[model samples]
Target: MIRAVAFDVGETLVRDDRYWTSWADWLGAPRHTVAALVGAVVAQGRDNADALKLIRPGIDIATQYAAREAAGRGEYLDESDLYEDVRPALAALYAQGVRVVIAGNQTARAGELLRALDLPADVIATSGEWGTAKPSAEFFARVVDAAQTEPGETLYVGDHPANDIVPARSAGLRTAHLRRGPWGYLWADTAEAAAADWRIDSLHDLTQIVSGAG
Candidate 1:
Protein backbone atom coordinates (compact mmCIF):
# COMPACT_ATOMS: atom_id res chain seq x y z
CA MET A 1 0.00 0.00 0.00
CA ILE A 2 1.22 3.49 -0.75
CA ARG A 3 1.59 5.66 2.31
CA ALA A 4 2.68 8.82 0.58
CA VAL A 5 1.86 10.49 -2.74
CA ALA A 6 4.31 13.03 -4.12
CA PHE A 7 3.13 15.30 -6.94
CA ASP A 8 5.09 17.27 -9.50
CA VAL A 9 3.84 20.87 -9.52
CA GLY A 10 3.87 22.08 -13.10
CA GLU A 11 1.73 20.07 -15.51
CA THR A 12 0.86 17.59 -12.79
CA LEU A 13 -1.32 19.57 -10.39
CA VAL A 14 -1.14 22.94 -12.06
CA ARG A 15 -1.38 23.46 -15.79
CA ASP A 16 1.60 25.68 -16.60
CA ASP A 17 0.29 27.25 -19.80
CA ARG A 18 0.13 30.68 -18.23
CA TYR A 19 3.52 30.31 -16.63
CA TRP A 20 5.20 29.32 -19.88
CA THR A 21 3.32 31.92 -21.89
CA SER A 22 4.47 34.62 -19.54
CA TRP A 23 8.05 33.38 -19.72
CA ALA A 24 7.97 33.34 -23.50
CA ASP A 25 6.63 36.87 -23.59
CA TRP A 26 9.31 37.99 -21.19
CA LEU A 27 11.91 36.21 -23.28
CA GLY A 28 10.66 38.03 -26.39
CA ALA A 29 9.66 34.83 -28.12
CA PRO A 30 6.26 33.76 -29.38
CA ARG A 31 4.36 31.57 -26.96
CA HIS A 32 3.72 28.93 -29.59
CA THR A 33 7.39 28.92 -30.45
CA VAL A 34 8.33 28.25 -26.85
CA ALA A 35 5.62 25.60 -26.65
CA ALA A 36 6.94 23.80 -29.70
CA LEU A 37 10.49 23.97 -28.35
CA VAL A 38 9.28 22.50 -25.07
CA GLY A 39 7.52 19.62 -26.85
CA ALA A 40 10.50 18.98 -29.09
CA VAL A 41 12.97 19.04 -26.19
CA VAL A 42 10.98 16.66 -24.04
CA ALA A 43 10.09 14.41 -26.95
CA GLN A 44 13.81 13.90 -27.31
CA GLY A 45 13.89 13.13 -23.55
CA ARG A 46 15.78 16.37 -22.79
CA ASP A 47 15.36 18.71 -19.84
CA ASN A 48 13.24 21.85 -20.13
CA ALA A 49 16.07 24.01 -18.83
CA ASP A 50 18.16 22.76 -21.70
CA ALA A 51 15.46 24.00 -24.05
CA LEU A 52 15.55 27.39 -22.34
CA LYS A 53 19.32 27.56 -22.79
CA LEU A 54 19.03 26.63 -26.44
CA ILE A 55 16.36 29.25 -27.02
CA ARG A 56 17.90 32.07 -24.98
CA PRO A 57 21.59 31.45 -25.10
CA GLY A 58 24.28 33.60 -23.41
CA ILE A 59 21.82 35.24 -21.03
CA ASP A 60 22.54 35.35 -17.31
CA ILE A 61 19.59 33.17 -16.22
CA ALA A 62 20.05 33.64 -12.51
CA THR A 63 20.25 37.40 -12.86
CA GLN A 64 17.27 37.41 -15.18
CA TYR A 65 15.27 35.34 -12.67
CA ALA A 66 16.28 37.67 -9.86
CA ALA A 67 15.26 40.69 -11.89
CA ARG A 68 11.90 39.12 -12.72
CA GLU A 69 11.21 38.38 -9.08
CA ALA A 70 12.43 41.77 -7.89
CA ALA A 71 10.17 43.45 -10.42
CA GLY A 72 7.26 41.32 -9.15
CA ARG A 73 6.67 39.50 -12.43
CA GLY A 74 7.70 35.99 -11.43
CA GLU A 75 4.62 34.77 -9.66
CA TYR A 76 2.55 33.73 -12.63
CA LEU A 77 0.57 30.72 -11.49
CA ASP A 78 -2.94 31.36 -10.15
CA GLU A 79 -5.67 29.27 -8.53
CA SER A 80 -7.33 28.78 -11.89
CA ASP A 81 -4.05 27.53 -13.26
CA LEU A 82 -4.62 24.14 -11.69
CA TYR A 83 -6.10 21.25 -13.60
CA GLU A 84 -9.75 20.60 -12.68
CA ASP A 85 -8.93 17.14 -11.40
CA VAL A 86 -6.19 18.18 -8.97
CA ARG A 87 -8.15 19.44 -5.98
CA PRO A 88 -10.65 16.61 -5.74
CA ALA A 89 -7.95 14.00 -6.00
CA LEU A 90 -5.70 15.65 -3.42
CA ALA A 91 -8.63 16.17 -1.06
CA ALA A 92 -9.65 12.53 -1.35
CA LEU A 93 -6.15 11.33 -0.55
CA TYR A 94 -5.85 13.78 2.34
CA ALA A 95 -9.13 12.56 3.75
CA GLN A 96 -7.78 9.01 3.61
CA GLY A 97 -4.84 10.05 5.85
CA VAL A 98 -2.26 9.59 3.14
CA ARG A 99 0.68 11.96 3.15
CA VAL A 100 0.69 14.36 0.19
CA VAL A 101 3.87 16.10 -0.84
CA ILE A 102 4.39 18.59 -3.63
CA ALA A 103 7.94 18.16 -4.85
CA GLY A 104 8.92 19.84 -8.07
CA ASN A 105 11.72 21.55 -9.96
CA GLN A 106 10.61 25.09 -9.23
CA THR A 107 12.12 28.39 -8.32
CA ALA A 108 12.71 29.82 -4.85
CA ARG A 109 9.31 31.53 -4.94
CA ALA A 110 7.42 28.35 -5.79
CA GLY A 111 6.18 27.74 -2.25
CA GLU A 112 4.88 31.29 -1.94
CA LEU A 113 3.13 31.00 -5.30
CA LEU A 114 1.60 27.68 -4.30
CA ARG A 115 0.26 29.15 -1.08
CA ALA A 116 -1.16 32.09 -2.99
CA LEU A 117 -2.92 29.63 -5.32
CA ASP A 118 -4.10 27.59 -2.30
CA LEU A 119 -2.78 24.27 -3.56
CA PRO A 120 -3.11 21.53 -0.95
CA ALA A 121 -0.27 19.38 0.24
CA ASP A 122 1.09 18.17 3.54
CA VAL A 123 4.56 19.28 2.43
CA ILE A 124 5.63 21.66 -0.33
CA ALA A 125 9.23 21.53 -1.51
CA THR A 126 11.25 22.41 -4.55
CA SER A 127 14.52 21.30 -6.10
CA GLY A 128 15.99 24.65 -5.15
CA GLU A 129 15.25 24.01 -1.51
CA TRP A 130 16.67 20.50 -1.61
CA GLY A 131 19.76 21.67 -3.52
CA THR A 132 19.13 19.00 -6.16
CA ALA A 133 16.77 18.53 -9.06
CA LYS A 134 14.85 15.52 -10.34
CA PRO A 135 16.55 12.81 -12.43
CA SER A 136 19.14 13.09 -9.67
CA ALA A 137 19.13 10.47 -6.93
CA GLU A 138 19.61 13.18 -4.31
CA PHE A 139 16.39 14.90 -5.31
CA PHE A 140 14.18 11.82 -5.07
CA ALA A 141 15.89 10.92 -1.80
CA ARG A 142 14.89 14.29 -0.42
CA VAL A 143 11.31 13.73 -1.56
CA VAL A 144 11.19 10.36 0.16
CA ASP A 145 12.65 11.98 3.24
CA ALA A 146 10.02 14.71 3.14
CA ALA A 147 7.30 12.07 2.75
CA GLN A 148 8.72 10.23 5.76
CA THR A 149 8.08 6.90 4.13
CA GLU A 150 10.09 4.08 2.69
CA PRO A 151 10.83 4.50 -0.99
CA GLY A 152 8.70 1.46 -1.88
CA GLU A 153 5.71 2.96 -0.09
CA THR A 154 5.95 6.36 -1.78
CA LEU A 155 4.25 7.02 -5.08
CA TYR A 156 5.67 9.79 -7.26
CA VAL A 157 3.23 11.23 -9.78
CA GLY A 158 4.40 13.54 -12.51
CA ASP A 159 4.05 14.41 -16.21
CA HIS A 160 7.67 13.90 -17.20
CA PRO A 161 8.81 10.41 -18.15
CA ALA A 162 12.51 11.20 -17.89
CA ASN A 163 12.47 13.66 -15.00
CA ASP A 164 9.72 12.06 -12.96
CA ILE A 165 8.89 8.46 -13.79
CA VAL A 166 12.31 7.09 -14.64
CA PRO A 167 14.20 8.73 -11.79
CA ALA A 168 11.54 8.05 -9.17
CA ARG A 169 11.39 4.40 -10.13
CA SER A 170 15.16 4.22 -10.10
CA ALA A 171 15.09 5.55 -6.55
CA GLY A 172 12.67 2.77 -5.55
CA LEU A 173 9.53 4.86 -5.39
CA ARG A 174 6.43 3.72 -7.25
CA THR A 175 5.70 5.93 -10.25
CA ALA A 176 2.57 7.31 -11.90
CA HIS A 177 2.84 8.89 -15.33
CA LEU A 178 0.08 11.36 -16.14
CA ARG A 179 -0.27 11.72 -19.89
CA ARG A 180 -1.30 15.35 -20.17
CA GLY A 181 1.75 17.63 -20.30
CA PRO A 182 4.45 17.91 -22.94
CA TRP A 183 6.73 15.14 -21.74
CA GLY A 184 3.86 13.02 -20.56
CA TYR A 185 1.87 13.11 -23.80
CA LEU A 186 4.89 12.90 -26.06
CA TRP A 187 6.47 10.00 -24.21
CA ALA A 188 3.26 8.24 -23.28
CA ASP A 189 3.89 5.23 -25.48
CA THR A 190 7.57 4.82 -24.67
CA ALA A 191 8.88 1.76 -22.84
CA GLU A 192 10.20 3.77 -19.89
CA ALA A 193 6.88 5.54 -19.42
CA ALA A 194 5.07 2.23 -19.67
CA ALA A 195 7.02 1.12 -16.61
CA ALA A 196 5.02 3.50 -14.42
CA ASP A 197 2.89 1.73 -11.83
CA TRP A 198 -0.04 3.77 -13.05
CA ARG A 199 -0.37 5.44 -16.46
CA ILE A 200 -3.16 7.92 -15.83
CA ASP A 201 -4.94 10.48 -17.96
CA SER A 202 -5.75 12.67 -14.97
CA LEU A 203 -5.26 13.12 -11.25
CA HIS A 204 -8.75 11.69 -10.67
CA ASP A 205 -7.31 8.32 -11.59
CA LEU A 206 -5.06 8.52 -8.53
CA THR A 207 -7.95 7.99 -6.13
CA GLN A 208 -8.45 4.51 -7.56
CA ILE A 209 -4.75 3.67 -7.45
CA VAL A 210 -4.30 4.85 -3.87
CA SER A 211 -7.46 3.25 -2.59
CA GLY A 212 -6.83 -0.01 -4.44
CA ALA A 213 -10.19 0.41 -6.14
CA GLY A 214 -8.89 -0.72 -9.52
Candidate 2:
Protein backbone atom coordinates (compact mmCIF):
# COMPACT_ATOMS: atom_id res chain seq x y z
CA MET A 1 0.00 0.00 0.00
CA ILE A 2 1.16 3.52 -0.74
CA ARG A 3 1.81 5.37 2.50
CA ALA A 4 3.39 8.56 1.23
CA VAL A 5 3.48 10.65 -1.97
CA ALA A 6 6.46 12.81 -2.92
CA PHE A 7 6.30 15.24 -5.85
CA ASP A 8 8.67 17.00 -8.21
CA VAL A 9 8.35 20.77 -8.13
CA GLY A 10 8.91 22.06 -11.67
CA GLU A 11 6.38 21.24 -14.35
CA THR A 12 4.72 18.82 -11.99
CA LEU A 13 3.24 21.10 -9.35
CA VAL A 14 4.62 24.23 -11.03
CA ARG A 15 4.08 25.06 -14.71
CA ASP A 16 7.59 26.51 -15.41
CA ASP A 17 6.26 29.26 -17.68
CA ARG A 18 7.87 32.00 -15.60
CA TYR A 19 11.12 30.06 -15.35
CA TRP A 20 11.70 29.98 -19.12
CA THR A 21 10.24 33.43 -19.59
CA SER A 22 12.73 34.90 -17.13
CA TRP A 23 15.63 33.28 -18.92
CA ALA A 24 14.42 34.52 -22.31
CA ASP A 25 13.85 38.02 -21.02
CA TRP A 26 17.24 38.09 -19.36
CA LEU A 27 18.98 36.99 -22.56
CA GLY A 28 16.88 39.40 -24.69
CA ALA A 29 15.66 36.45 -26.76
CA PRO A 30 12.17 35.53 -27.82
CA ARG A 31 10.37 33.19 -25.44
CA HIS A 32 9.30 30.74 -28.14
CA THR A 33 12.86 30.35 -29.37
CA VAL A 34 14.16 29.42 -25.93
CA ALA A 35 11.20 27.10 -25.27
CA ALA A 36 11.79 25.35 -28.59
CA LEU A 37 15.46 24.95 -27.74
CA VAL A 38 14.50 23.52 -24.37
CA GLY A 39 12.25 21.00 -26.12
CA ALA A 40 15.03 20.13 -28.54
CA VAL A 41 17.50 19.50 -25.75
CA VAL A 42 15.04 17.33 -23.82
CA ALA A 43 14.21 15.46 -27.02
CA GLN A 44 17.89 14.74 -27.59
CA GLY A 45 18.04 13.29 -24.04
CA ARG A 46 20.60 15.93 -23.07
CA ASP A 47 20.52 17.82 -19.81
CA ASN A 48 17.77 20.45 -19.78
CA ALA A 49 20.42 23.03 -18.90
CA ASP A 50 21.81 22.32 -22.36
CA ALA A 51 19.07 24.60 -23.65
CA LEU A 52 20.84 27.52 -22.00
CA LYS A 53 24.14 26.43 -23.58
CA LEU A 54 22.47 26.23 -26.96
CA ILE A 55 21.59 29.89 -26.48
CA ARG A 56 25.00 31.07 -25.18
CA PRO A 57 27.92 28.67 -25.26
CA GLY A 58 30.37 28.55 -22.30
CA ILE A 59 27.90 30.36 -20.08
CA ASP A 60 28.33 29.64 -16.39
CA ILE A 61 24.79 29.09 -15.07
CA ALA A 62 25.64 29.28 -11.35
CA THR A 63 27.47 32.56 -11.80
CA GLN A 64 24.56 33.87 -13.86
CA TYR A 65 22.11 32.90 -11.11
CA ALA A 66 24.01 35.17 -8.76
CA ALA A 67 24.15 37.85 -11.46
CA ARG A 68 20.42 37.70 -11.96
CA GLU A 69 19.83 38.17 -8.25
CA ALA A 70 22.18 41.16 -8.15
CA ALA A 71 20.24 42.62 -11.09
CA GLY A 72 16.93 42.03 -9.21
CA ARG A 73 15.80 39.33 -11.64
CA GLY A 74 16.46 36.15 -9.72
CA GLU A 75 14.29 33.08 -9.18
CA TYR A 76 10.74 33.88 -8.18
CA LEU A 77 7.79 31.77 -7.10
CA ASP A 78 4.28 32.47 -5.84
CA GLU A 79 0.81 31.01 -5.79
CA SER A 80 0.35 32.09 -9.39
CA ASP A 81 3.08 29.69 -10.46
CA LEU A 82 1.23 26.69 -9.06
CA TYR A 83 -0.89 24.51 -11.29
CA GLU A 84 -4.67 24.44 -10.84
CA ASP A 85 -4.73 20.94 -9.43
CA VAL A 86 -1.93 21.34 -6.92
CA ARG A 87 -3.55 22.73 -3.78
CA PRO A 88 -6.76 20.77 -3.91
CA ALA A 89 -5.11 17.47 -4.75
CA LEU A 90 -2.39 17.79 -2.15
CA ALA A 91 -4.90 18.76 0.51
CA ALA A 92 -7.12 15.89 -0.40
CA LEU A 93 -4.27 13.44 -0.09
CA TYR A 94 -3.34 14.89 3.25
CA ALA A 95 -6.92 14.59 4.52
CA GLN A 96 -6.96 10.96 3.49
CA GLY A 97 -4.24 10.30 6.06
CA VAL A 98 -1.48 9.88 3.51
CA ARG A 99 1.83 11.64 4.00
CA VAL A 100 2.38 14.30 1.32
CA VAL A 101 5.86 15.48 0.34
CA ILE A 102 7.31 18.01 -2.05
CA ALA A 103 10.80 16.94 -3.10
CA GLY A 104 12.27 18.17 -6.35
CA ASN A 105 15.37 19.29 -8.21
CA GLN A 106 15.11 22.88 -7.13
CA THR A 107 17.29 25.45 -5.44
CA ALA A 108 17.04 26.33 -1.76
CA ARG A 109 15.26 29.59 -2.63
CA ALA A 110 12.62 27.65 -4.49
CA GLY A 111 12.15 25.47 -1.44
CA GLU A 112 11.68 28.58 0.71
CA LEU A 113 9.09 29.93 -1.69
CA LEU A 114 7.29 26.61 -1.62
CA ARG A 115 7.24 26.67 2.16
CA ALA A 116 5.89 30.22 2.15
CA LEU A 117 2.94 29.04 0.07
CA ASP A 118 2.07 26.70 2.95
CA LEU A 119 1.07 23.86 0.72
CA PRO A 120 -0.43 20.86 2.44
CA ALA A 121 2.56 18.60 2.92
CA ASP A 122 4.48 16.81 5.60
CA VAL A 123 7.89 17.57 4.13
CA ILE A 124 9.06 20.02 1.49
CA ALA A 125 12.67 19.69 0.33
CA THR A 126 14.89 20.51 -2.61
CA SER A 127 18.07 19.15 -4.15
CA GLY A 128 19.93 22.24 -3.01
CA GLU A 129 18.84 21.64 0.56
CA TRP A 130 19.60 17.93 0.37
CA GLY A 131 22.99 18.44 -1.32
CA THR A 132 21.99 15.86 -3.92
CA ALA A 133 19.88 15.78 -7.05
CA LYS A 134 17.59 13.28 -8.67
CA PRO A 135 18.74 10.50 -10.99
CA SER A 136 20.88 9.81 -7.94
CA ALA A 137 20.04 6.95 -5.61
CA GLU A 138 20.90 9.03 -2.56
CA PHE A 139 18.23 11.60 -3.35
CA PHE A 140 15.38 9.11 -3.52
CA ALA A 141 16.67 7.44 -0.40
CA ARG A 142 16.31 10.79 1.33
CA VAL A 143 12.78 11.03 0.00
CA VAL A 144 11.87 7.68 1.48
CA ASP A 145 13.56 8.67 4.68
CA ALA A 146 11.61 11.91 4.80
CA ALA A 147 8.36 10.11 4.17
CA GLN A 148 9.14 7.92 7.16
CA THR A 149 8.08 4.94 5.11
CA GLU A 150 9.68 2.00 3.43
CA PRO A 151 10.78 2.42 -0.18
CA GLY A 152 8.03 0.28 -1.64
CA GLU A 153 5.32 2.26 0.09
CA THR A 154 6.63 5.67 -0.83
CA LEU A 155 5.26 7.04 -4.11
CA TYR A 156 7.49 9.51 -5.89
CA VAL A 157 5.81 11.52 -8.65
CA GLY A 158 7.35 13.75 -11.29
CA ASP A 159 7.16 14.82 -14.91
CA HIS A 160 10.71 13.87 -15.87
CA PRO A 161 11.08 10.12 -16.22
CA ALA A 162 14.88 10.36 -16.15
CA ASN A 163 14.96 12.39 -12.96
CA ASP A 164 11.81 11.02 -11.38
CA ILE A 165 10.57 7.62 -12.41
CA VAL A 166 13.79 5.85 -13.35
CA PRO A 167 15.79 6.52 -10.22
CA ALA A 168 12.89 6.27 -7.79
CA ARG A 169 11.91 2.91 -9.18
CA SER A 170 15.50 1.77 -8.98
CA ALA A 171 15.45 2.71 -5.31
CA GLY A 172 12.30 0.58 -4.83
CA LEU A 173 9.89 3.51 -4.43
CA ARG A 174 6.78 3.21 -6.54
CA THR A 175 6.82 5.96 -9.15
CA ALA A 176 4.12 7.93 -10.94
CA HIS A 177 5.15 9.45 -14.26
CA LEU A 178 3.23 12.69 -14.63
CA ARG A 179 2.63 13.61 -18.28
CA ARG A 180 2.39 17.33 -17.61
CA GLY A 181 5.44 19.05 -19.11
CA PRO A 182 7.64 18.95 -22.23
CA TRP A 183 9.85 16.13 -20.96
CA GLY A 184 6.71 14.46 -19.70
CA TYR A 185 4.75 14.61 -22.97
CA LEU A 186 7.84 13.89 -25.03
CA TRP A 187 8.90 10.79 -23.12
CA ALA A 188 5.66 9.56 -21.59
CA ASP A 189 5.50 6.44 -23.70
CA THR A 190 9.20 5.68 -23.66
CA ALA A 191 10.41 2.44 -22.13
CA GLU A 192 11.97 4.27 -19.20
CA ALA A 193 8.76 6.06 -18.28
CA ALA A 194 6.71 2.97 -18.95
CA ALA A 195 8.50 1.21 -16.13
CA ALA A 196 6.78 3.51 -13.65
CA ASP A 197 4.29 1.85 -11.36
CA TRP A 198 1.74 4.39 -12.54
CA ARG A 199 1.35 7.21 -15.09
CA ILE A 200 -0.94 10.14 -14.49
CA ASP A 201 -1.87 13.38 -16.25
CA SER A 202 -3.11 15.21 -13.20
CA LEU A 203 -2.49 15.23 -9.46
CA HIS A 204 -6.20 14.61 -8.92
CA ASP A 205 -5.71 11.16 -10.41
CA LEU A 206 -3.60 10.21 -7.43
CA THR A 207 -6.54 10.12 -5.04
CA GLN A 208 -7.97 7.23 -6.98
CA ILE A 209 -4.59 5.57 -7.23
CA VAL A 210 -4.12 5.71 -3.48
CA SER A 211 -7.61 4.45 -2.74
CA GLY A 212 -7.15 1.59 -5.16
CA ALA A 213 -3.87 0.69 -3.56
CA GLY A 214 -5.76 0.10 -0.35
Candidate 3:
Protein backbone atom coordinates (compact mmCIF):
# COMPACT_ATOMS: atom_id res chain seq x y z
CA MET A 1 0.00 0.00 0.00
CA ILE A 2 1.11 3.53 -0.68
CA ARG A 3 1.39 5.45 2.54
CA ALA A 4 2.63 8.67 1.04
CA VAL A 5 2.53 10.62 -2.20
CA ALA A 6 5.20 13.11 -3.29
CA PHE A 7 4.36 15.68 -5.96
CA ASP A 8 6.23 17.92 -8.36
CA VAL A 9 5.32 21.57 -8.20
CA GLY A 10 5.50 23.24 -11.61
CA GLU A 11 3.19 21.84 -14.27
CA THR A 12 1.98 19.27 -11.77
CA LEU A 13 0.25 21.39 -9.15
CA VAL A 14 0.73 24.72 -10.87
CA ARG A 15 1.17 26.25 -14.30
CA ASP A 16 4.08 28.72 -14.37
CA ASP A 17 3.07 30.93 -17.27
CA ARG A 18 2.93 34.10 -15.20
CA TYR A 19 6.10 33.18 -13.34
CA TRP A 20 8.14 32.66 -16.54
CA THR A 21 6.53 35.65 -18.22
CA SER A 22 7.55 37.74 -15.25
CA TRP A 23 11.10 36.46 -15.53
CA ALA A 24 11.18 37.25 -19.25
CA ASP A 25 9.85 40.73 -18.58
CA TRP A 26 12.51 41.30 -15.94
CA LEU A 27 15.25 40.06 -18.25
CA GLY A 28 13.99 42.35 -21.04
CA ALA A 29 13.28 39.41 -23.35
CA PRO A 30 10.13 38.48 -25.27
CA ARG A 31 7.92 36.23 -23.18
CA HIS A 32 6.96 34.06 -26.14
CA THR A 33 10.61 33.63 -27.07
CA VAL A 34 11.66 32.56 -23.58
CA ALA A 35 8.62 30.35 -23.14
CA ALA A 36 9.37 28.53 -26.38
CA LEU A 37 12.93 27.91 -25.26
CA VAL A 38 11.66 26.53 -21.98
CA GLY A 39 9.36 24.09 -23.75
CA ALA A 40 12.11 23.07 -26.14
CA VAL A 41 14.50 22.42 -23.28
CA VAL A 42 12.04 20.22 -21.42
CA ALA A 43 11.15 18.40 -24.63
CA GLN A 44 14.81 17.61 -25.21
CA GLY A 45 15.18 16.32 -21.62
CA ARG A 46 17.47 19.20 -20.65
CA ASP A 47 17.39 21.04 -17.36
CA ASN A 48 15.32 24.22 -17.23
CA ALA A 49 18.21 26.03 -15.57
CA ASP A 50 20.36 25.15 -18.58
CA ALA A 51 17.70 26.67 -20.81
CA LEU A 52 17.84 29.92 -18.82
CA LYS A 53 21.57 30.31 -19.47
CA LEU A 54 21.04 29.38 -23.10
CA ILE A 55 18.32 32.00 -23.42
CA ARG A 56 20.52 34.77 -22.01
CA PRO A 57 24.16 34.06 -22.64
CA GLY A 58 26.74 35.34 -20.14
CA ILE A 59 24.05 36.25 -17.57
CA ASP A 60 24.78 35.29 -13.97
CA ILE A 61 21.94 33.04 -12.84
CA ALA A 62 22.35 33.68 -9.13
CA THR A 63 22.40 37.43 -9.72
CA GLN A 64 19.29 37.22 -11.88
CA TYR A 65 17.43 35.19 -9.24
CA ALA A 66 18.43 37.67 -6.58
CA ALA A 67 17.24 40.55 -8.69
CA ARG A 68 13.85 38.91 -9.15
CA GLU A 69 13.55 38.32 -5.43
CA ALA A 70 14.60 41.84 -4.53
CA ALA A 71 11.89 43.28 -6.78
CA GLY A 72 9.24 41.59 -4.55
CA ARG A 73 6.72 41.55 -7.40
CA GLY A 74 5.88 38.42 -9.42
CA GLU A 75 8.41 36.42 -7.42
CA TYR A 76 5.86 34.18 -5.79
CA LEU A 77 2.87 32.23 -6.96
CA ASP A 78 -0.61 32.42 -5.45
CA GLU A 79 -3.75 30.31 -5.46
CA SER A 80 -4.56 31.61 -8.92
CA ASP A 81 -1.40 30.00 -10.19
CA LEU A 82 -2.45 26.50 -9.18
CA TYR A 83 -4.19 24.01 -11.41
CA GLU A 84 -7.92 23.36 -10.87
CA ASP A 85 -7.13 19.73 -10.17
CA VAL A 86 -4.61 20.46 -7.43
CA ARG A 87 -6.68 21.35 -4.37
CA PRO A 88 -9.30 18.64 -4.82
CA ALA A 89 -6.78 15.92 -5.53
CA LEU A 90 -4.67 16.87 -2.53
CA ALA A 91 -7.77 17.07 -0.36
CA ALA A 92 -8.92 13.64 -1.44
CA LEU A 93 -5.53 12.13 -0.59
CA TYR A 94 -5.53 13.85 2.78
CA ALA A 95 -8.99 12.48 3.51
CA GLN A 96 -7.61 9.00 2.93
CA GLY A 97 -5.05 9.50 5.70
CA VAL A 98 -2.26 9.58 3.22
CA ARG A 99 0.85 11.61 3.94
CA VAL A 100 1.23 14.18 1.15
CA VAL A 101 4.41 15.99 0.28
CA ILE A 102 5.34 18.59 -2.29
CA ALA A 103 8.88 17.78 -3.36
CA GLY A 104 10.38 19.47 -6.35
CA ASN A 105 13.18 21.48 -7.89
CA GLN A 106 12.21 24.89 -6.55
CA THR A 107 13.67 28.03 -5.11
CA ALA A 108 14.64 28.56 -1.49
CA ARG A 109 11.46 30.56 -0.90
CA ALA A 110 9.17 27.78 -2.10
CA GLY A 111 8.22 26.67 1.41
CA GLU A 112 7.21 30.21 2.32
CA LEU A 113 5.31 30.59 -0.94
CA LEU A 114 3.39 27.37 -0.45
CA ARG A 115 2.63 28.37 3.12
CA ALA A 116 1.23 31.68 1.94
CA LEU A 117 -0.90 29.81 -0.59
CA ASP A 118 -2.11 27.42 2.15
CA LEU A 119 -1.45 24.35 0.05
CA PRO A 120 -2.76 21.11 1.55
CA ALA A 121 0.32 19.09 2.20
CA ASP A 122 1.98 17.63 5.27
CA VAL A 123 5.46 18.60 4.13
CA ILE A 124 6.77 20.88 1.39
CA ALA A 125 10.36 20.60 0.24
CA THR A 126 12.38 22.41 -2.37
CA SER A 127 15.65 21.20 -3.87
CA GLY A 128 17.32 24.42 -2.78
CA GLU A 129 16.48 23.61 0.83
CA TRP A 130 17.00 19.86 0.50
CA GLY A 131 20.42 20.27 -1.12
CA THR A 132 19.64 17.89 -3.95
CA ALA A 133 17.48 17.89 -7.06
CA LYS A 134 15.41 15.27 -8.83
CA PRO A 135 16.86 12.57 -11.12
CA SER A 136 19.39 12.17 -8.35
CA ALA A 137 19.13 9.09 -6.15
CA GLU A 138 20.15 11.10 -3.12
CA PHE A 139 17.23 13.49 -3.54
CA PHE A 140 14.60 10.79 -3.88
CA ALA A 141 16.11 8.94 -0.94
CA ARG A 142 15.84 12.09 1.11
CA VAL A 143 12.22 12.53 0.04
CA VAL A 144 11.34 9.00 1.10
CA ASP A 145 13.15 9.53 4.37
CA ALA A 146 11.28 12.77 4.97
CA ALA A 147 8.00 10.99 4.39
CA GLN A 148 9.05 8.40 7.02
CA THR A 149 8.13 5.61 4.69
CA GLU A 150 10.01 2.96 2.78
CA PRO A 151 10.49 3.84 -0.85
CA GLY A 152 8.17 1.02 -1.88
CA GLU A 153 5.40 2.58 0.17
CA THR A 154 5.74 5.93 -1.54
CA LEU A 155 4.28 7.10 -4.82
CA TYR A 156 5.70 10.01 -6.79
CA VAL A 157 3.56 12.03 -9.17
CA GLY A 158 4.94 14.52 -11.64
CA ASP A 159 4.79 15.69 -15.22
CA HIS A 160 8.48 15.28 -15.92
CA PRO A 161 9.25 11.65 -16.59
CA ALA A 162 13.03 11.88 -16.60
CA ASN A 163 13.35 13.98 -13.48
CA ASP A 164 10.29 12.82 -11.59
CA ILE A 165 9.06 9.43 -12.69
CA VAL A 166 12.16 7.54 -13.81
CA PRO A 167 14.32 8.59 -10.91
CA ALA A 168 11.63 8.05 -8.32
CA ARG A 169 10.96 4.58 -9.68
CA SER A 170 14.68 3.84 -9.61
CA ALA A 171 14.69 4.95 -6.01
CA GLY A 172 11.93 2.34 -5.40
CA LEU A 173 8.83 4.51 -5.40
CA ARG A 174 5.85 3.77 -7.59
CA THR A 175 5.28 6.55 -10.08
CA ALA A 176 2.26 8.15 -11.72
CA HIS A 177 2.84 10.11 -14.89
CA LEU A 178 0.40 13.00 -14.97
CA ARG A 179 0.00 14.03 -18.61
CA ARG A 180 -0.99 17.66 -18.50
CA GLY A 181 1.99 19.80 -19.44
CA PRO A 182 4.23 20.05 -22.49
CA TRP A 183 6.84 17.63 -21.12
CA GLY A 184 4.17 15.24 -19.96
CA TYR A 185 2.35 14.93 -23.28
CA LEU A 186 5.47 15.26 -25.37
CA TRP A 187 7.29 12.46 -23.60
CA ALA A 188 4.28 10.26 -22.95
CA ASP A 189 5.54 7.61 -25.31
CA THR A 190 9.14 7.65 -24.13
CA ALA A 191 10.54 4.45 -22.61
CA GLU A 192 11.27 6.06 -19.26
CA ALA A 193 7.82 7.65 -18.97
CA ALA A 194 5.99 4.58 -20.19
CA ALA A 195 7.42 2.68 -17.21
CA ALA A 196 5.24 4.57 -14.75
CA ASP A 197 2.78 2.44 -12.83
CA TRP A 198 -0.06 4.73 -13.74
CA ARG A 199 -0.68 7.50 -16.25
CA ILE A 200 -3.63 9.90 -16.06
CA ASP A 201 -4.86 12.91 -17.97
CA SER A 202 -5.56 14.99 -14.89
CA LEU A 203 -4.69 15.18 -11.21
CA HIS A 204 -8.35 14.70 -10.33
CA ASP A 205 -7.95 11.17 -11.57
CA LEU A 206 -5.35 10.64 -8.83
CA THR A 207 -7.93 9.99 -6.13
CA GLN A 208 -9.26 6.94 -7.92
CA ILE A 209 -5.80 5.88 -8.99
CA VAL A 210 -4.38 6.06 -5.48
CA SER A 211 -7.41 4.33 -4.00
CA GLY A 212 -7.15 1.57 -6.56
CA ALA A 213 -3.44 1.23 -5.94
CA GLY A 214 -4.24 0.53 -2.30
Leading candidate by TM-score: 2
What is the RMSD of candidate 1? 1.6
Ranking by TM-score: 2, 3, 1
Residues 47-147, model 3: lDDT tens digits: 77676787788889888888777887546778889999899889989998889999888877876787677777999988989889888999999889887
Q: Where is model 2 poorest over a 10-residue stretch in terms of lDDT?
A: 205-214
Please give the lDDT score at residue 163 for candidate 3.
Answer: 89
Ranking by lDDT: 2, 3, 1
> In model 1, what is the error at residue 145, expressed in angstroms?
1.3
State the TM-score for model 3: 0.94
lDDT of 2: 0.92
Off by over 4 Å in 3: none
Candidate 1 lDDT by residue in tens digits, 1-214 = 9899999988888887887787787788889988888777776767665656777888777887778888877656676888888888999889888899998998768766786766668888888777888889999999999999999999999988888999999999999999987777777998988999989997888888888884
lDDT of each: 0.85, 0.92, 0.85
